[model samples]
Target: MAKKLSSAQLQELAIEKKIKRRNFISFSAFFIGAGAAFGGWKWLYNSPQETAGITAGTRQPLRRALNKTELFFRRIFSNDHVVKTYPKERAAKVVRVNSDIGMSTDNFNAANWQLSVVKKNGHVLKIGIEEIRALPKTEIVYDFKCVEGWDQIQHWAGLRFVDFMAHYGLQEQAEMEYVGMETPDGAYYVGLDMESALHPQTLLAYEMNDQPIAEVHGAPLRLIIPVKYGIKNLKRIGTINFSNQRPRDYWAEQGYDYYSGL
Candidate 1:
């Protein structure tokens, strides 16, 4: 048999039970409020209207966040951080070609192709492919990274972009913050920072794998900027522009990052 509690003791026990119940209720409310906040945040993150602009595709908020993160890193990035190179023996015999936006040259005449450089001062210089080839050639064997989660170790031979700029007396123009390039028909385009453009390994490549670059692989002239992802390497480049402002980028406009660095 249990002894009955005294009145005072019973009162104290009832108070204790009430306090415990209040604590439990408070805890439950806190958790519910926290959960509601988290759920609201998730909904806002996925809200297209809330996060819509230039980067408006699948997962807009995440893409925008990544772009901001990449830009922040690029701001503190080092020019000395070069892409690693491998021995020529490690180069791929045949590199895969993707993105066919600018590859179609059915009516285009390679012989008449000229690389046009537009300076910040509105000065334009039309340079022939032969003139570009006449410049000293720089060769590199490095990993060519693509944004599609694939990469290839390839050998590229071309005139250094810095050398090309110097040859054309555009060193001052090269100091611009951005460099923009596009295909002849304006089918595709890319923008680059001057730092990547001036990297020692970045090239206006005319040869690949110890021979002249085949037509299928950006022949005549193409950008071979190892510092950036392969997409920034505009192939069969027809126009080059230097700008103090951020230039328009094809992939960036399509919900990709403007600074597609390695």
Candidate 2:
């Protein structure tokens, strides 16, 4: 048989148990509420269009809540805007060259390929592949990070982008905020900021993995900017233009970030 507790002791034990139960209930409620709020917010904010009679416009408060939620997530998930490097041992043997914008042209003639560097309202500089090859060649084995969260480390050989720009005497152009490149057929193109175009690892590549660039890999001439996503690293150069206004990018026009860089 158990001894009965005194009234005071019994009251104290009851209070303690009540407090513990209240704490557990409070914690459980907090998490449940949080999850529901997040789900409600997302459903409202991301639904740009209406379903039946329901519309994002009908849930203005929820949408605003979700805007705050996105801001919080952006702060938490925004990785330290730094480029990652790996040793040669860790580098991938076959780095895929994905973009084929300027490559699939009837007149992409690699034998007669020439890079035209255009300045605003001035004479353009036409440079042959040999001229670019004559400049100091640099090899960078770096990770090619895509905006879609994939990366590969590949060896690249080319003239430093800044040096190449300097060689053409277009570096001093203060009005050039954007650089635009297009395939000969103009099917695909990209725009980049001057800062990204001049990153240390950026190159105007003509060779990959110690061999001449393959036809599928922007043979003869290509832009290699490791600091940016693959979309900005245009392949098969046709025309290079410097502009003050923001240039049209093939992807950014389709709701991607214009400055898709590290």
Candidate 3:
């Protein structure tokens, strides 16, 4: 004897089958997507790595990706590109200071602070703060952007980096590929490409918000560069070196973007 199902029973059985089919397809798709992501990560992990002198390797693929990103931004970047400026009234009332790396009393003495510049030809020049102030002054009221995603309007006054280079007769060094700036103790350092280093708004700033720059905010001498995030504006510059090869960057060595353009 065979049993026959009613229309109601047949419809219920069809719905159940469709539900199971849909679930299977959904699970299959989820697993496939997960596997693809894991496979990509694994491939990158197994890629070849090259050794740099002090650092062993950061993996070639990741380094290449960072370099490509830098190149992409640089294609559209230029000194002539003007950064937005604000009225001095909008500047932050209280100076905000961060990263006191080389600003400690043990490392810095404003009395003995003389800029040390090393030329490509191995010549060294010691520059005093007074000499820097004597150069034509430029002031800018602009937003100070930080990598941590906070920004404040800042008022800064100092000499244009280009004029400083010209005043020092550093024409040869200015033409070099890179510039390196370090704190007195060499605790913190940043490398700059020539184009950005010579940006018209880049300044060796000594004043902020209509007053002398405070000790907490790199007093007497610091770089006020509008185009870069605060990190590129090396505080309490101790030494400047010129080279054809890319100079070392503190943040870049730790996997931050070397170019770090806006």
Which of the predicted structures, 1 or 3, would earn the higher TM-score when compared with the native?
3
Clashing residue pairs in candidate 1, if any? none
- With candidate 1 superimposed using the best TM-score fit, by how many Å does residue 123's alpha carbon deviate from the native? 2.4
The Cα local distance difference test for each model comes to: 0.85, 0.74, 0.85
**Which 10 consecutive positions of candidate 3 have the poorest summed lDDT?**
49-58
Write the residue-wise lDDT of candidate 1 on 45-86 in tens digits: 666632544333446565767778877877887768888999
* Residue 95 local lDDT, model 2: 72
Please report, as a residue range, the 10-residue window in candidate 2 with the lowest summed lDDT: 49-58
Per-residue error at 43 for model 3, in Å? 3.9
Model 1: CA > 4 A from native: 1-45, 49-60
Q: What are the runs in model 3 whose C-alpha is more than 4 Å off?
A: 1-39, 45-58
Candidate 3: clashing residue pairs, number: 0
Backbone clash total, candidate 2: 1
